[model samples]
Target chain A: MNAEDAGANLAREADESHGRTVAAERRALVQALILVLLTLWTFRDEVTKSVAQASTMTQAAHGLALPALAVMLLYCRRAELSRDLQKGSWWGAVLIILAVLAYAVTTWPFYVSYVRKLQFVTAFAGIALVVGGWRILWRCGPLLVLTGLAMPIGWNTYSTLSIRPETLTMDTALKALNLLPDMVVRLQGTELHYVHAGVQGVVGLGDAHNGLAAPLALASVYVFVTFSRVRPAWQSAILLIVAIPVVALGNLLRVLLHACLTVWSGAMPAEGLPRDVALVLSLVATYLVVAAASIVLDHLFVEEGGDSRVATTIRR
Target chain B: MESKDIVRTGAIRRLCSPIFGTTALILLVAAVALDPAMTALDIHFRKTSILPRVSLSAFDAATLPSFKSAPKESPFLDPHPDDDAGTRDHVLQRLQERDANGTDGQVILFVTYYSDPNDQVPHTPEVCYRQIGGVVRAIGSRTVELGQGDWPKRVEVRTVIVEQELANAAIAYVFCANGRFYTRRNEVRLALGWPGDKRVYFSKIEAVSRFERDEQPDLAMARACKLLSEVLPALLTRHFPRQADLKHRAVGAAR
Candidate 1:
């Protein structure tokens, strides 16, 4: 090949490389600016108060861990995200506009309430769409949404919204207590009075036993994690479907265990080593339930057949 | 390019594309709808919870009691006193009143109200008091019959003896909805039901009286209850709105 022709080709290549570098730099700058704005918006008064006083330490801890988990998930799926950058659709602008509108509406006096953080999620998703496009959203939507878990919601809010399910939980716990030999359970509201051998024990299922919020928060993250890992569409769907029950069963176990402890120890103290023990026990029970449900889901759905090698591995 | 063309041809993409944004929007709406917070109906109650507008013109400060509101200097004093600000907001009105009427220590009155069934009613002192740097020694609930009204209400008050490091205190609190009284927080909540528009406006009259370390916890509780019985009735008449009162006032105004 001639030297002149080779030099011309090299100059064209350099120009192309410079153009790509400039585009990447611009993208990075835009992302940084968006992050700065989001940070300013998110750490406002209401959100700060909520985060500072997250309902429970367990919740706070999980919430704190969510960002890291999301990052890890993103890193794990970097290949997919990299491949997805082939095109940036105009629909991203639509998402950004919708999210900004939502954020604006939520900021209004009457609209700023329990679920205000959801708008922040919407906004972040919008930013992702604007920056990385629809495929980025489809790939990273759950992770972006994972940031919502960081927003604090009190368990009492659950009691107000999901009173029926909580009442059911309390009732089921009462029934379980009654089924225990020599344990007579009487219910008044969410309180269960256990009378056995002249010892009367009263356990009031307060906001802590509201039954939905904690489990829902935990299961949402778990399902997101499961989805990030498991590729099979139907299996992930099954896991998603089972999350509620798995969480509910764990909560039920907590209530029943607390009742048993009350029956044995007499008068559940409000705050002490005993209360802490019960909380830890409840968490353990919840994780165990989740694990068991996951195994069952994997065996029944993901593995195809009961006697299959996959099912055997799942069983083991 | 069209959304379909840009969206990758995959099972997950196919599943999510049509419904994901819609689902998220629905989820947000459902949360706001089912949620007990930030709705138009509850906004009035939410505002009231923060700063209840009870006309205190009738309350003659000189004749009734020589009580000075707790000084702003108290370190342990909470700016937002309620356990859950998201639920109750400013409804849980707290006052640290220094009494000149021969009471040994200050009287702390924590008045909490919930008009929405979705609103947060006050919990037992064991749960509320014990969490805020107080060690609870004994907790009990009993019905205390107060006043000779058309409906002779037997109000259930939970008495608690909280042992703080600097001092010890006894607290007696009762949960009441409209004119009706409930023995427990759960009972009040159950009575309220799950509605954006609440049927009853509930309030908890919590009275706290501190004492010397030597004073018996039971004695402190009795004094606290006495102080509560005095303050609560008047506060209830002033602060918490009643449907019956509204009806009665409407009738009187018509005449």
Candidate 2:
């Protein structure tokens, strides 16, 4: 064959090979997408129910915000994720298998809403792994993880985690108020009793007022969403570590103010401000504390070498 | 377009292969099969009350039964107003009856119905009692026989023994959903969670009565059930569809 003809043949062969690679990539993407879509569609009822419950229930208000935030974060990171796609993992098959088994188990309907959603998320993660391998999972996993907030951590769990911490916060509030003259404060479980100038002020730190669940939930969302932006392992760790105290302190402040109001007003009117309005007031205080803490943390943990430590740690 | 030709395509064939394709098909079927039919039971009707006033001889014999409508002003503050703000709020009827026997017997019958399965049955008396400044000490469940004879009807109820300072009382309530009566919370949840189960109108019939501190909740519940039983059949027939009552009763009567 002539030299020019041979070169043309080689060029055609290279073009064909590239086309084949692109086709393969497309196939994998389609497979992954379809699997995830089907899994979500199958569990839409569970998802809807959990969302509805979360929206209605005061304590689980985080459930509604989480998925939406996660979606936004995912959208923000889409470019980076697509740029960082990696080859499929054999280990991903193991995840897919486990997820399938979980899918089957969750079908029984005996599991609570959160457990079912947890399983569904696991299956989605497994599908992602099988489709795009480990890199895609690590890059995109946080968004999937955030979807978990859509499911409420069961009421029993909420109660267990809330009661002690709230009681502690109330105790701390009483101690802080002890310095103030003409105020007598006593705490019984989650109930607060105050007698100032013979005016009895009683406030109960209920599930909504517990101040534990919302802060933890909000903090987790903050950390996970900012996982990409925050630098170093220690900063994210510090953010998580400080979340409880910030939340507790905010709650303490709110309760103290509320008690003071009760003492001054003799009592909140029988109907009082709605429970939800009160919860929002506390949450506003919590947001301020969290925001201030986040600022200080951001300054302290300035990104080094433009790399996230958790991402690096996962790689290792 | 031939079946063999389609089967020869590697992608289609691989997906349709015994393991993956079969598994997918089975799972899809299982998901559909297991999906709760009542996840969002939708019934569209705008009315004040689903249940008619059930005035019985016994209720009248004890003392003339007095019917009082739930207050309309500031429904959010009221215990349960008929004009609840929640669009999905269950249709509720609250009537307070005084015992005519001069024994100072007072009973409050609170009837609630849900047209949407997603609209949950209201918080049980355990929660309701607590919300209303009462301390609940003991909670239990029991089945009460309402009718006599070969085909005797029975109603299951949850009893909450409550104490508010000097006043002592018992709250006995039954939740009838999809035609099945559930006294306990878990039973109702399980039935509602069951995959593809049809959603139907369900009612929460709650009767609250004053009881002596020494009286057992069982006795109070039995009395409540007897009083409730007088109107239950007629109420169920009027409010719930015949099929829901018949099918659920047939399947769950033994339980």
Candidate 3:
């Protein structure tokens, strides 16, 4: 054959090969989507209950936005997922079996609401592994972790986890409130009682405000680490580690703000718009502080192959 | 085709294999089967009788003459509006002494009965009081003698002093599960979760009393204990089911 004809033949073969790869990826994507929907259908009751609680309960409010955040993260990492997709493993089947058995046990013989809710995430992970293999699971690990954290926790669990942070926030707020002119502050467990300018009020740092900032801050930091292009392993670790105290500081600031509002307004709005606004402000402030820290860390460290890590089209 | 393309094609082919398809089918079937299985088990368990002979609503505070029912607006009692009706029957009442000189003598009575073994043990004052912004200090358990003729002559109750900003109160509570009295929540869980007991139930009897600034803390504890002794005997006789009745119901249920 002449060189021109040979070149044309090669180009046609390459086009067909590319077409086949694209078709295969599209089929796999469709299959994965179906598996995810089936997993959701399997755990519909848990999902409904979680959504209800997330909508109504202040502590679980973060849960309402978590699935969306996870979906956003997955969408952003679509190219990475396509690049990482591989053969399914038998281990995933084993994981699915174990997760299903756990769901059954928690459902029937012993009704553990927490573990049952957790099975939704576990089953999703198993499906990911079964459909897209380990590389895809690893690629989507942060989103899965975020999804797991989004599960609605029981009050008992919330109280147990929040007690220390609540105590710290209250104690710090008490000291700060006492600094004000003619302000006498007394902390009774989670309640902050203050007498300022002859107006008596009690600001309760109840379960609603307990250590909430920390998890929120941590979740925000995780999202930052996942989305930011320059995050090395150490930098992500630093951001996560720094989030705890930043959240504590944010919680302290929130309580102080709420207390001042209560004292000045002569009204203690515990669970209404005022408290919600304060909580949101605190979370935003915490995120800002973490973001600042991330920027500082970026400046401090020299990331290797930073340009190469940027998003690239998947080529087979 | 390039080797990378070949590898990608092979991986995708493996993912679409019949083995993975069967696994997916099994998962889908399991998901579909779970709800019905859970419902069947619930039905089977509900058939085993586990209710009190007389409901907690039968409790008549008029039997105790010194205490009168206080209004709902009374700040002494914790209004637990989130009590689950499916697994728990909760009754809370604030009682004031008609002849008492001050608010120090007022008593808050809380009673809750649980028929579901799967539910967590009832919240103790240590946790509940703390949740409501009370600093709880545990004072060891003591036996409160009930002079009334019953299977048990006395019951052991745990006491805690809850210090709030505006008020200092004392709380005393006991858990009765399956004809056994327990001073701790874990003990109550053990009693309720014990095998072979088809008719399982537990009730928490809690009494709370506030004391004035100058009044002794012991006085508040004594007031709560006094109200508890009066209420316990009446509850056993009127509200809670007897052991014989429970056994008979269980036998009938089994048949």
Instruction: Give all candidates' CA lDDT scores.
Output: 0.56, 0.56, 0.70
Best by TM-score: 3
Q: Write the per-residue lDDT of candidate 2 for residues A1-316, one digit (tens) a residue.
A: 9999999999999999878666556665666656666666666776677777778776667776775676677666655566565666655556655655555455444444445668766766666676667778877666675766556676544543454455566667889776688888765434456777777767654532334655555554455544545244576577667766665665666667666655665665332443344546766766665567666766554444355763463333
Candidates 1 and 3, the one with greater DockQ: 3
In Å, residue B127's CA in model 2 sits off its true spot by 12
Q: Enumerate residue pairs that collide in model 3.
A: none
Chain A TM-score of model 1 comes to 0.73
What is the DockQ of the complex in model 2?
A: 0.07
lDDT of 2 by residue, B46-66 (tens): 111222223221122222133
Question: Residue A311 deviation, candidate 1, in Å?
Answer: 14
Please identify model 1 stretches exceeding 4 Å from their true place.
Answer: A1-43, A55-61, A154-157, A208-211, A267-269, A272-282, A285-316, B1-255
lDDT per residue as tens, model 1, B146-234: 57554445567887776665567777877766656766655665445433322346767677777666877766676667656656556
Candidates ranked, most accurate by TM-score first: 3, 2, 1
DockQ for every model, please: 0.03, 0.07, 0.26
Task: Name the regions of candidate 2 deviating beyond 4 angstroms.
Answer: A1-33, A90-100, A103-113, A207-212, A228-230, A257-316, B1-30, B33-255
Residue B124, candidate 1: Cα error in Å is 19
